[model samples]
Target chain A: MDVYKNLDWEAVEKLKISSGSKIVLKRDLNFLRSEENISVQFLLDGEVKGSVDCHLCLDNKDIDENSRNYLYPYFTESMNILLGRLISTDPMLSALKIKLSPPKCTIYSKTIDSRLMSELVVYSLVINDFDFDVVLNLNLTVIN
Target chain B: MKEIIPLSELRILVVDDSDFSRSMILQILSEAGCQLVTETNSAEHAMKLIREKKPHIVIADIVMPEISGIELTTKINDNFDNIYVIMISSLSQEHVVLEAISSGASDFISKPVQKNQLIESIQKIAQNISKE
Candidate 1:
């Protein structure tokens, strides 16, 4: 089945917790070609491990600098905060001493509406497992 | 036939990844009577500027890309005997605080830094430097 052909962009957009938040539901045309998968996981309040995987597609021929600059910092800071929160809450995980294995970012380009669209893939992880029940909520704030 | 001031003139270098934070610190230092203030967005740039300008005090953010404030302070202390380093950070992590002190930071201040708090920290640095 062609997942990209039936992708509900609206539903994916609705799942976004913040204006800059990236959420991926399934693999797309881009994921199949790159042979890579992006995932971000956060453990909240000593339990409740949650993760998201992202797959992006772009034409790869024409990409712009503005889009790359805009996306890079946004993703980096959000992931840092998410990971920091997880580390702070989980004492057991802190003892296990998991550390971020440096972030990997890739850029690609695609032609959409006769214009080049740039896509970025960022993968991050946060690990924490405890017995307590917890709820996870994502919040993004504008830095001034 | 010259007037002597109670507080010596200070040349301060403020380093932070955030432009907003650097500007806030600069404004606070300026108001506190610091005559020369230099600002940099990263610790590497800050070290280069520090070597060139030879500022009396360096106020740096603890967490940054590439080199961190602690690393910067350690490098400065290794080469420069007279300069003072004050670390400013939003993080109050115990490990971070201990690392900053161990790395030769003269003091650490928590962020959302108020004008008075900044002035006090600088004053403390100035006084300590004068004693040494």
Candidate 2:
């Protein structure tokens, strides 16, 4: 699968987080797309309430390489760092409830690790600041 | 620098299907002072080792072929005693959470596994095991 479909530059531009706000990034595997979708949310007082989507793509060929070993982990850890940044920059999301779901898809490959999949979603949620009661509706497929 | 106890001294087993996940956990545990950490990519091997070695703790993924973490925990509890199992996964679904706990897991840690979170959870489990 071709990983990089297209960067949503418009979404990136729409980010309105202020300076020094805390951000939390999370990633969700869209079983429909066979791709990982990243979300960046802002955090305040350990709550995520606001977020922006940060989509990442990976080539199927890369999955064949040793480099793929770092793909999921790096994506996840980087998002965590970004979340820390959002927390420092914008704390407004501390009180708002946030909800997120993976793109619609019915059939998902179960060969992938669940933690890897969750890392993808968590990475997406790391960049934006949001509140505590936000609901993250995640859609996952178990492909055998 | 935090004066935390090292994990290397504790016997740890990492169970996951992916080489990357196993390696990542191994690295993290090693850095945390785990010295006798073993890695298994399949639940079958993991269960076999649990029955034989009886490590201090088992860090296992939830979804796997042959035997899932829930089943493994159940079998371990049925056959052995005093082995701590920590279920790790990306999904925080209520059903899975309940199953892991019901299956004799000490705790469930969500993924993507944060270094601090994993360390803290392991430390807590270790402390509990020591108390027993």
Candidate 3:
């Protein structure tokens, strides 16, 4: 089968992650080519907030939950790659004010903060029994 | 006879704030038979390495702590007369690219460095070296 037929870009957002690469996933096409990971709402420029959350599968079967923390940098680099694809495909945004702040990672907790409400548009995919998701929670803005 | 420079013979420095990015770039360069490649997680350290090792090419990320890639490029332009800077970033905005070039980048590549893309860049730079 031709894998090229399955690869194409849809639309995407140009948001940023805390200390991560520039945020570029805003739609289905771009997300399809990207790896899985998480992005929160604290990074975007406007009052419109929420995170571009991503899900990715680890290639190494050796990593268990205990060593999962070791994969943090990988996930960050993956985001950079994904964002690069979007930018490469779209050259028009080069002139915008396009301010980018440093990536700010938040520890997961049980409670939702003030600016982010949980309005979610979620998509899920499973390949070879490994599942992935990319979610955009617009109401899920972050305060930072 | 005129001499030719291959990617393997060139000295390179990979600069980024992320450890994974540095490792990933390093892996790609190494796989392409690059012999002299060094990596630093920040632009500050990049300057020191540039002065010490004097790599022919500097592949750098734009958004970084302490020093952004544009500033670093400016520094290189001012002090380092012979080094070529390649700007890499997740930010694809037009203004950002222009800023990088104006600041002294010889070329620009977006993040998520692909092997072919990098090799092609190295070849282009190597060709320029041969020409000069």
Q: Pick the candidate with the highest DockQ.
A: 3
C-alpha lDDT of candidate 1 relative to the true structure: 0.52
Q: Pull out the clashing pairs in model 1.
A: A58-A109, A59-A109, A59-A110, A60-A109
Give the per-residue lDDT of model 3 (tens digit) for B1-132.
Answer: 657677777989999987877877888888899988998988999999998998889999987868988899999999988789999887666667888999999888876666788888888887766523
Tens-digit per-residue lDDT, A33-135, candidate 2: 3243332232221123223333334314234445434444444333333333332233232122222211122222223233443323322222233221111
**Judged by DockQ cut-offs, is candidate 1 incorrect, acceptable, medium or high?**
incorrect
lDDT of 2 at B54: 65
Per-model CA lDDT versus the true structure: 0.52, 0.51, 0.61
lDDT of candidate 2 over B19-68, digit per residue (tens): 54567678788778778888897778987887676688889877555677
Better of 1 and 2 by TM-score: 2
lDDT of 1 by residue, B1-132 (tens): 333222336778898875545665776777677777889888888878987998888998876767878889999999888888889765445565677899998888865566777787777666655421
**What is the i-RMS of every prediction?**
6.0, 10.4, 5.9
Classify candidate 2 by CAPRI docking class: incorrect
Best-performing candidate as measured by TM-score: 3
List the candidate 3 regions with Cα displacement exceeding 4 Å.
A1-9, A12-67, A81-95, A107-129, A134-144, B130-132
**Interface RMS for model 3:** 5.9
The CA lDDT at B35 in model 3 is: 88
Off by over 4 Å in 2: A1-144, B1-6, B130-132
